[model samples]
Target chain A: MSELATLTLAEAREKLRAGETTARALTEACLAAIEGAAALNAFVRVDPERALAAADAADARRAAGEDGPVLGLPIGIKDVYCTEGLGTQSASRILEDFVPPYESTVTMKLREAGAVALGKCNMDEFAMGSTTEHSVYGATVSPWRRAGDTAPLTAGGSSGGSAAAVAADLCLAALGSDTGGSIRQPAAFTGTVGIKPTYGRCSRWGMVAYASSLDQAGPMTKTVRDAAILLGAIAGHDPKDSTSAPREVPDFEAALKGDMRGRRIGLPKEYGADLPDEIAALWDRGAEMLRDAGAEVVEISLPNTPHALPAYYIIATAEASSNLARYDGVRYGRRASLGQGDGIVDLYEKSRAEGFGREVQRRVMIGAYVLSAGYYDAYYLRAQKIRSLVRADFEAAFGQVDAILTPVTPSAAFPLGEMEGDPVKMYLQDVFSVTLNLAGLPGISVPVGLSGEGLPLGLQLIGRPWGEAELLDTAFALERAAGFGHKPESWWR
Target chain B: MSIDTDTARRIAGLARIRVEEADLPGLAGELSQILGWVEQLQAVDVSGVEPMTSVTPMALPMREDTVTSGDMRDKVMANAPDAREGFFAVPKVVE
Candidate 1:
């Protein structure tokens, strides 16, 4: 393996600042890596010229004495985030030409720090499915597979491309949205570290809305520190995003201590109750590792977990239905234009019918029905009430724990097309991660080990709202203890 | 939770998406399965619980009603598919 390919963003930043490496060189290295990993389908679009241009400017800025942690680092942006000049299609054909006039708040901040955009990574259409199979571009496969390994493992969805790109070293780190488990599950599947920060910790102004209530953008990187560095660069209050929390953002790097000598971590019983032996074993081993790091581990229960999946589907699909309504042919997105000289209503009907995919159209119909006349009180309104109960479940757990540990997924990455026909089966992928979104809590997925079939497994860490610093620190400790940061087989020397 | 073809067609109309009558059966089956999944929420008892409108329990920051939007009629219409003299043009609603 190329040792340089495994370098973290922190190391890349230090190297770039010390004059040992130029931003252009780093960007070139990432682009070269992207070229090598192209067969893995890790990128939806790659902007080498733009990336090098930004890098050259960063080099000039540094010569003139300007600074930032991400100065000149190459980053892959998930297509969901609107890049000012880049076509920000959420991996859906509907918004294929819908370029935004303004940059997403997070992407703008990345540029402010002198980070170069490699290009947009692919994702599930509108971030709806757990597998990127829903993407108009096609599914992103795992980079860790070998010959005769026909398991066809998922890289995980929505953020699968970001995870695969990071794992394959196509970019130093990438941005991914976590509407459900988009970020964390893909991270687990691809053997990378991904974080979904507390809702509002990062502004969502230009991110194409999925489940607006649950959507959050965070970093997918090779290590925990990269996640923190990226988090500090992109997180803070934004005037454009009313939902952006106005609280002062903490210096995450300053809090990344190797020692967690006297902290409390909770292990939720509900997260462990129905064990698929292997997954349960992963959790037990994770708790032991945390305990070994001098952290206190206590078993706690979030009793409402059984209801979490149900409540999440209700709240998420409900919000998804509304957020995705903007894609009607009238405004932005592909116009269906059936019946050439038809009236407005006919144009809308035709355009929507042709423009949206099956899953998106289904959600819209469901959302409109649920929010319609008589059913509102029974469905959408009732789901919102249950959403509160779910939030309370996390609030009650956080009172006793500084951070919570659990498995990132119920099972290791299954074969691609395995869950394609079954949406319900695929949704179970978010069972461990969605509750954190419901409570607006920050969470990260760290690779723990490989499954018997040689696929990556991950452990999840949940933190209090705005408590990402402590969360990353604990992950850094366990990351060191776990010693599982091996590169995927495809990248072998 | 099994949506009939008629229910599916009604939903498609409500959502303003056109679907052929023949496609309604497949859509109805899919919608029915999804609704079945959503019905799982009914099992949770949230009788006294309040609906969560936003995270952090913050109220909408209210302000006196004022029209502060920019006067960009022409600029706003620039992206419209069909616009005429600073106005978005659509087929006449009623003749």
Candidate 2:
């Protein structure tokens, strides 16, 4: 194994600061990793020249003794984020060559803090599906899978690329956006730790909007501490985004406490109910682990859990329909030819018909129907009502418990084509999630143990509004209990 | 209500997506199954429940009624299929 490949962001930064390793060496190691994993389809594009140039600048800054946690570290950014001079396609054919003039708030912060941008990672187009299968580019396979498994297992979507790249050690850590379970699900599937911080905790100013109400960006990393360090580099108030929270971002790396002595963790009754037997066993074992680590664990019910899926689909698809309306071919992406004398309406219809994918079209249609004049009362309004009930359920549960524990997905990663024809079944994979999106709460997925088939399972920790520290403590405590230290085989390396 | 092929085609058209006639039957079946899953929501009695937009119960923030936005005209129009004199030029709709 390569020396720089094994170093965490913390270790690599320390070495860079202490003159032990040059930023060029670290960037070169990451570039080699990316080149080695070319067959895995982790990155959409890699500009070696630009990345090295940035690294050289970081080395100069360090020589001047200026320091930041992420300075000189190479990070993979999801293509969904707008990075200047790099294509920000969101893995959709629509924006295949669209490069934004300005950088995303998160990207701006990363650059200012001195993290080298390795390249853009692939994702489900517009952050649509559960598996990365929906990407126009191609599916990103799980690095955790063994050889001869021709049918690659899912690296969870829409941030599956980000998680897979980090798991394969192609980049120190990657930025991922979670609209519903995008980040956490992919993190669980790949055996990496992912945090979807509290809504508005990180600015979504330039992340291509999936569902404006629910989309949040966070870090995917090999360990909890690495994720914290990356989060510290990115989290802060941005004047560009009105929704960006103004709360003080505590030093996330320093906040990692293995001691959970007085914390009360809730075991949501709904998560374990009717789940696959193997997944239930994992959830039970996770609760036991937390209990053994000197934490109080108790059963709590979020009775409105069953209603969360329906409410979320309605709210998310509704917002997505409105947000995606800007994607007519005349703006950005592919366009269908229109007759010279054709009117604006005809132009719009033709452009949209050619630009969007089938799944995106399905969502827009469903959303439009729900928000249409006659059905708004019956569909959209009713969904909003159920949304409040779902939020109230969390409030009630949090009154009794600090953080809720559950399985990230009802099951482990399934094969690529398993849920192809059934979009609803794929959406059901988000059941254990989505409610967090509706409530705009922070959630993290940490690897627990293996299932009966030896696939990895993850325990999800959800916190109250702005409750990331408590969530991380619970995750660290459980990570110790799980002892899931295995890495993916060399095919990925 | 079970959706048929006709309904599926109409919905696809309304959503501005082009679908072949042969694809309608499969879509109708898949969409109907989804509706069946969503129908589970109707069974719960939310007769007096207030619809929720966000998790917190706070009202919308009332900000000063001042106009503020970026002037990235060149950037915003960078991807336009056709542009003329710093504006998006579309085919004339009205005579």
Candidate 3:
């Protein structure tokens, strides 16, 4: 493996500034690493030409005295973000050959910050399932596997590809879109750091909408500082996104004071009730690590926690059904061939049926059912109220705690086909991380330890809305105390 | 409430995705199980809780009603599956 490919985004910026390495050298090293690790299937497409062109441009600008934060950084973009002239399918066959002429705000911001685009990462079709198995491109297996086990483990989803890419060193960092547990779960599974920023922190303009309200983009990287640096560059208010927060973007990297003295952290009693003993033990040890750093850890009550997943499915799927209605096959993407007497409605029906995969179709159906007449109040409205309670529960908890720490997932990465029997079985994986999206809070998953089987497990620290700076700081302290330094053996290649 | 194939067909129709008659039963079965799991939310006491319209508590910022962008007829129609006379072509709705 190229050592250049393994450098964190923060470390690479220093090397580039010292004239010790060129952007072209870093980009080419990542390209070489990507080519050598095809079995990972982390990237759906690798644009070496585009990557080289961008890197060369970055190098030129640096020589001209421009000092942007993310300048010369090589990153993988999730397929969910619309990268102009590059295929942005969101991993659905319906958009198999679809290429947007416009760019999503997040990617445009990354490019404007001088980041080089290595390629598009794979994800679940429409960001629906917990496993990436629902993708048209197939499952993105995690880089980590149980000791002595040869089975291919899932890297979690719908941000599975970005997590796998960062974990396997395919890029310095990658963009991940989180609606439910997409970013954090995958990061936990891969032992990389992923954060889902407070809702409205990142503009959704030009990104493929999953659940309009719940979906937000954040960074998945090898370390917390890299996450802070990359997140600062991409988040801000956008006139195009009406729901985007009209507030000041902070210097997130500077918040890494790394001192946990007197900071209050909450361990929600609702979490880990049903988790495996090892996961709960890892979480307990994480609390101990934080306690060792002088932070006051307390048992807090997020009383509405158990209802979060049910409410999330109802609300997110409802939004997804409405958002996905835009893909009617009249423009930009695959249009199923029709026969005589077929009208536009049939065209819409057939194209959608043929385009959406199993999980997506199921969610859309459930979404439509909930939103349909007679059930709207029985399902969607009640779920929205439950969502309000989920938020209120957090509001009450935040009254006493600066941040709440919980396990990122119910368990570590499971083997493929383990949850295929029932779709709800898969939905249960998001139980630990879904409530934050409902409450519109910022949450970061930092890998603190490994499961006994040897897969990485992460702890989540959720902060108040727009409180990512403090959240990242607490996570930084926890990370320092744990000093987790395990890497999966090179087995995929 | 368990959904029957008839209700599943109705949902697929509302969703605008075609489902075969044979597939409706399986789809209904899966949806029933999911909804059965989700039914737990119905027991929550939300009488005083309002429906959360947005995640963040920010007031929806309003902008003046004006066309900030336009005049890209070619760009607008570029991704159309079929275009006729600079417009998206579709099956005749009038019949």
Model 3 over residues B1-95: C-alpha lDDT tens digits? 79998888889999999999998899889999999999888788988889998788777888899999899888777777788898888888895
lDDT of 2 by residue, A296-405 (tens): 99999999898899878888888888888888767666677888787776777777766676777778877766777777887788888888888888989999988899
Question: Candidate 1 — what's its lDDT?
Answer: 0.84
Could you tell me which 10 consecutive residues in candidate 1 chain B have the lowest summed lDDT?
B73-82
C-alpha lDDT (0 to 100) for residue A448 of candidate 1: 94
How close to the true structure is residue A126 of candidate 2, measured as C-alpha lDDT?
92
lDDT (C-alpha, whole model) for all candidates:
0.84, 0.84, 0.91
The root-mean-square deviation over C-alpha atoms between each candidate and the true structure, in angstroms, is 2.2, 1.9, 1.0
- lDDT at position A484, candidate 3: 79
Choose 2 or 3, whichever is better by lDDT.
3
Candidate 2: deviation at residue A416, Å?
A: 1.3
Interface root-mean-square deviation for each candidate?
A: 1.8, 2.1, 1.0
Backbone Cα, N, C clashes tallied per candidate: 1, 3, 0
Model 2: clashing residue pairs? A384-B51, A384-B52, A385-B51
Instruction: List per-model TM-scores for chain B.
Output: 0.87, 0.79, 0.92
Best prediction by DockQ: 3
lDDT of 3: 0.91
- Candidate 1 lDDT over residue span A331-376, tens digit each: 5567764555688788778877777777778777888888879888
Tell me how each candidate scores on DockQ against the true complex.
Answer: 0.61, 0.57, 0.85
In model 1 chain A, where is the ten-residue run with the lowest total lDDT? A145-154
